[model samples]
Target: MSNLPKTMKALVAYGPGDYRLETEHPVPVCGPDDIIIKTEGCGVCVSDVKCYHGAGRYWGSETEKAWVEPPFIPGHEFLGFVAEIGENVKGFEIGDRITADQILPCGECRFCKSGRYWMCQPHKMFGYQNTNDGGMAEYVRYPKTAVISRVPKELPREKALLIEPYACSKHAVDRAGVTNEDILVIAGAGTLGLGMITYARMKNPAKLVVVDMIDERLEKAKDFGADIVINPSKEDAIAKIMELTDGYGCDIYIEATGHPSSVKQGLAMVRKLGTFVEFGVFAQETSVDWSVIGDGKELNVLGSHISPYCYPFVIEHMTDGSLKTDGLIKRTFPIEKWEEAFEYASGKYGDFKVAITFD
Candidate 1:
């Protein structure tokens, strides 16, 4: 505490498409129920890309409410060491390695009371809302109510940063309710999609197909235990899936591609009464035929939001090498080169995950 600096570098998002690096941002003060963390690294997520592109979900459309209040930092997936702890903060000490759930639940909400804190009505996401600054800085304050966990000291930096996404992916796979007889298809081979592959593989389904536009990502999917990888750009994905399924269609279709077309494609490729799990966050509204979900196929549509109570499981799997993290983190940059980091994360170089590092 004696050597702590008064100010530190942070990246602040001023508006929909405006993000700036601030070198003199104030180091957050620990409240009675909060703790200050010295950020080690923060991963750039697809949600961050959507927020950067001024997606309606973050900026709001005519029918939606904007959730992001700018002038706030924009990182949620991160790991750090506790630099300072409040008097009332417990189970954590200075220099403890920690990471927090991005969604800060209001314990009083109906969802929270029902044990579904991930869907709490008044939740404040660490990076998007004004209540808490994100980890795209030297320090981030973890509110008392936030679900915090101590990361294993032996975990590699890249694997540690994957905890959040892996948790979310676990939620998605669990929601899919996969079985040995089921033929599953996961659309997209990005971060979340790759994580989905890791968890879905554990189910030992009859067939596990991965769809991606990039050949490199598809190849990585193979390394992650994907039975089949489809390059949508080079092949008619729906036709191929139909042929493989003998026109019966796949039993489970998980959409992890943020592209709107993937939704329609999933609808077209899923068998009747099959489960369709939508896990991606789209940048805009996507309209599809309603009958396909009701009268036509009677598909079971499930929505996976964020990691709820699956963090511990994800951490265990990551620690045990069940979830491979070797090729996941493609690049890392100092917090000062946030613009460059964002650019690389934006898919200009077909990178998987990009992280901003401190020191």
Candidate 2:
């Protein structure tokens, strides 16, 4: 082994409104069952903006109370190749292509033992804190527990980077319990919303209607297999769905936009005995009016957190090209141009799913 540097260059946040290109960070070390991976690609997600910009802090940790010093790496959703493996690491070797779950769970926790590692006690996340430095840096170390699955040789790095959000959508679909005959409505045509569209299409629903504030996103939704697209800004989304469904609303209404108003709209748009899935991540407190569901609507509202038990399913879909993602990835950037990537992904430059590619 070469003598590795104790510090490396990484894009670090000094504080709120304070991000800079910096170096001299200690490289994460591998444990007995850990694996060190050299990042191949990283995606710029909206959650990253919430943490770096002013919307909210990552992991709900106060800015001043964060563990690592200012200027830490950022980017949890990524794909990489194994650079090194720990002594006890098996079933994987150096040069193996893989994507991580980004969630580090305590295997001893009851939730983890029960195959609910996503809800692991003392849960730590990559790129959110020191748990792992994440892919924004040159390399990251992860205990075997974090490795989700090996990336298929046919799956491009760009598509593999989508596994994280895809797992999220898969979890929502699993919880929503959409079947071949169910009518479904997805609110918000953004990345997460689009992922829902892609995954739900696998179920071959009777009708898949997508509602978005932006026409462009609605168009993207159509490309992702939404049977009908409605721009809520120009039309009454709920009324449109009702008319399309011949007065009865969709059997499943999913709220992918964090805006509470959209959630409320979904509630009003779903039919009685329908399922409402909440997949959006709200940065601030939100409120909803329940009167719409007061008259025995027989509604099933499910709150979905980060993914669990769906990594393999996501990987399979991505590998087979059944879920087309290239249309969803709007831009790619070199790791050095992360700031530009962030700007493009923030909707400032009219881009979606911007990814950072490492040489």
Candidate 3:
């Protein structure tokens, strides 16, 4: 234990646009029921960007209080190698690669007690609160209550870092309940949308369509299993989906883009009595009329939060090479260049994905 460094580099948050990189941040100590990891890498997700910009969800709105606990490290899409294990920790060793779901249920909460821990009342997500410092630092501690899982050594660290997002993506697809006879249209070509495409393709939907404004993302969506890609900036996306479905509209529409337009477009592109899943994290409120949902379509509108029990299923596919990761994660930066990494992820450099690495 004395061999570990006392202090390390970390990105600490104070407020909007106030993330500071500290070189002498104290390295966390392992509690009796907790373990510490030497972070290998952490993915820069759009949620991190939204938080950086002080989105009402992360920061607070006048009506609804803030969700973020502020002044906490904020990278949830992350993984690392276990450097120190608590004496009470079982089934884990010092050199094992592992990761945990972002949601840290209190174990005694009603939802956690009933096995629906993803909706834990406290909603103590990592990277948001001080109690759970995220992987934005050189080292991170996993609490005794954390739901941990092993990342197979067979998968590359880059791909392994995707376990968290892919887990959420898999859960969204599962919510859609797609069938071979259904036409599924996913809005957005970002990581989560593409992830939805990957898992939805496995469901063998009649036609898997992706809608996005970016040409580059649409191109990669093809490789990820989108049967057709529509760029809304050029052509009418809702009209295109209707045309592909013979004017009936897609049987299922999943919104993964945080943009407000994606919400309205999905409502119009989904057929009557269709299933619509909303999985995006919007920086602003997306106000849409519900009349079309009740009086006109009677659609099954569903909301998906963080990943629940999909880690194992996603890990198996990732290890077996069934999942594709070509254009995704096309960019990386050393922790020293985290500012650039964040800017690149905010679509400044047109990179598909951005990750900050640690040694």
- Cα lDDT of all candidates, in order? 0.89, 0.79, 0.88
Indicate the worst ten consecutive residues by lDDT in candidate 1: 1-10
Residue-wise lDDT of candidate 2 within 1-359, one digit each (tens)? 52446766677766666766666766778778888888888888888877777553443356434433344577888878888788898888778988778687878899889988888887777776655567787777887678458888678777888898888887888898988888898888787778889999989999888988888888888888999998877988888888877888889988888897887788878888789888888766677667666665868889898778778888998888787686678589886788888888887666768888878
* Global fold similarity of model 2 (TM-score): 0.92
lDDT, residue 47, model 2: 80
Error of 3 at 7 (Å): 0.8
Show where candidate 1 strays beyond 4 Å. Answer: 1-3
The better-scoring model by TM-score among 2 and 3 is 3
Model 1 accuracy (lDDT, Cα): 0.89
Best by TM-score: 3
Ranking by TM-score: 3, 1, 2
Look at candidate 3 and give me any clashing residue pairs.
Answer: none
lDDT of 1 at 337: 84
Alpha carbon lDDT at 75, candidate 3: 90
The lDDT ranking, best first, is 1, 3, 2
What are the models' TM-scores? 0.96, 0.92, 0.97
Give one digit per residue, the lDDT tens place, for model 1 in 1-359: 43579999999999987888899988888788888899999999878877898888789888889888878998999989999888898788889999988899888989999999999898789899767789899999998888888888899898999999888998999999999999999998888889999888999999999999899999999999899999978999999999999998999999998789999999999999999999987766799998999999999999999998888888888999988877888689998888788889988888889999987
Model 2 clashing residue pairs (backbone): 12-71, 12-72
Note the clash tally of each candidate. 0, 2, 0
